[model samples]
Target: MRCVVLPGVYPPQEDTLLLAAALRRERLPPAARVLDVGTGSGALAVAAARHGAAEVTAVDVCGRAVLTARLNGLLAGCRIRTVRGDLLCPVAGERFDLVVANPPYVPTPPAPRPSRGIARTSDGGEDGRTVLDRLCAEVPAALRPSGVLLLVHSALCGVRPTLALLAAAGLRAEVADRALVPLGPETRSRAGWLLRRGLLAPGQEKEELVVIRAERV
Candidate 1:
């Protein structure tokens, strides 16, 4: 899908495509409602809509991303409801049959100043779980019974913890898809920091991106 990502809005990347591919393989319920958290360019939202979602709602914390997603949805001939809010806050108390997310998962050093602009797209705190942990805790609440969530993140963020958190939330979670890709610019820039933190081995040039499928049953 061709999406117009405005300046500062995150463009769809490997993780987004990985999650989208998982979404395509999922058996969505009839007239399923879908939610795309951290919608960014709305690529996943558009994908969900095209994949037969009856209604698609996309949420993003960045205003630019919201606009970019909304515009992309229109361009793609998909009706995506884009909202600007943190994580699932915009859709509180709403349940969806499917949810997808490709949040910031790159491990970044602790800076005196918080990440801003496009940096926010991949700034996953010191351990890279800051946002991922929050998503694991919050997504279950937004899912309907039998609902499925497809989330993509780097292994550096600790997949086990994500599974544990989802399990603790009463969801059945498993690694659904994975790919070994060269480190993205964001991750590459932090290779030294990741190595120091033991998240990356010396000279490890590739990062494994994992797509986790969690079902609320």
Candidate 2:
């Protein structure tokens, strides 16, 4: 699907495609509701709508991203509710049958949280679990019974920890899919730092991206 990404919004990348492919494999129930957290370009949101979701909500902290998602959804002839807020905040008290996220998971050197622009798309903090951890903690509460959460992140971010966290949250979690993708610009830019931190090996140009599926049974 074509998306009109705004200047500062994050365009669809390999991670986005991975998560969307996983979403397509899901057996969404009739009248299923789906939530796309960090819907930068609304790619996943559009995918969900086209996948037969009864209602799709796309959320992002960036205003431009939210606008981009709305426009893309309209262009795709999909009815999507777009909201600008931190992950899952705007949908507080709401529940969905499926929640999809391709949040920031690139490990960055210690620095203040990004408040704007494209940096927000890949600034996953030092250990790269910043947003992933929060998603594990909060997504379960946002899911209806039998709901599923499909999240994609780099292996450098500690896949086991994500599974453990989701398990501790009372969800059945497992690695649903994985791919070795060449490091993107953001990851390549921090390759040296990642190697120093042992998150990357010497001359490692490819990173493993995993799609984790957690179901609230």
Candidate 3:
């Protein structure tokens, strides 16, 4: 399949398509401004454009990924404003009515994988909650009053704790979708072993992606 990320950058464009597709089907209000965090290959930004969002802002920490996202936006005929900065760093002065993030949720490092963004961010930190924690805290500030924030993360990555954290952050969250997939031998060997031993069940090759939307209250 054609990769979504630019050559040599990682996080093939195909990686974000599933979540991007889901965002495309959303019914947005008039002239809604949407922000996509961790926009590795610009998949979500392009998808937001396709979904009829009036303004789309996509950000990534890696410069190569930012350039790739810009090119993808151009190729897709979308005017996604690409920003080179860490999460919420570049877009400090902006707020969006709708925000979507496929942030580096994967906290665990990949087992010699081709792309790092897809697998590495999969580590949620110790209990797979690091990235989610930042989202829970920063997302609210990045969203407009009454804005909607959509987040997709692994259930094995402390999904319940993530929900609780969101609530504590003053955002009311509700699950939107979930999917489970099997783990690879290498990952199952490295991270999965700890998870399988009655622990946090992290690093599972077969795991669920829980789609959740929280409104800034």
The number of the candidate with the highest lDDT is 2
> Candidate 3: global Cα-lDDT?
0.71
**lDDT (10s digit) by residue, model 1, range 75-126:** 9999989899989888999999999999888888998535458888999888
Which TM-score value belongs to model 2? 0.99
**Candidate number of the best TM-score:** 2
RMSD of 2: 0.7
Q: After superposition, how far is residue 188 of candidate 2 from its true place, in Å?
A: 0.8
lDDT of candidate model 1 versus the reference: 0.91
TM-score list, all predictions = 0.97, 0.99, 0.82
Model 2 bad stretches (over 4 Å)? none
Ranking by TM-score: 2, 1, 3
Candidate 2 clash pair list: none
**Preferred candidate (TM-score higher): 1 or 3:** 1
lDDT of each: 0.91, 0.95, 0.71
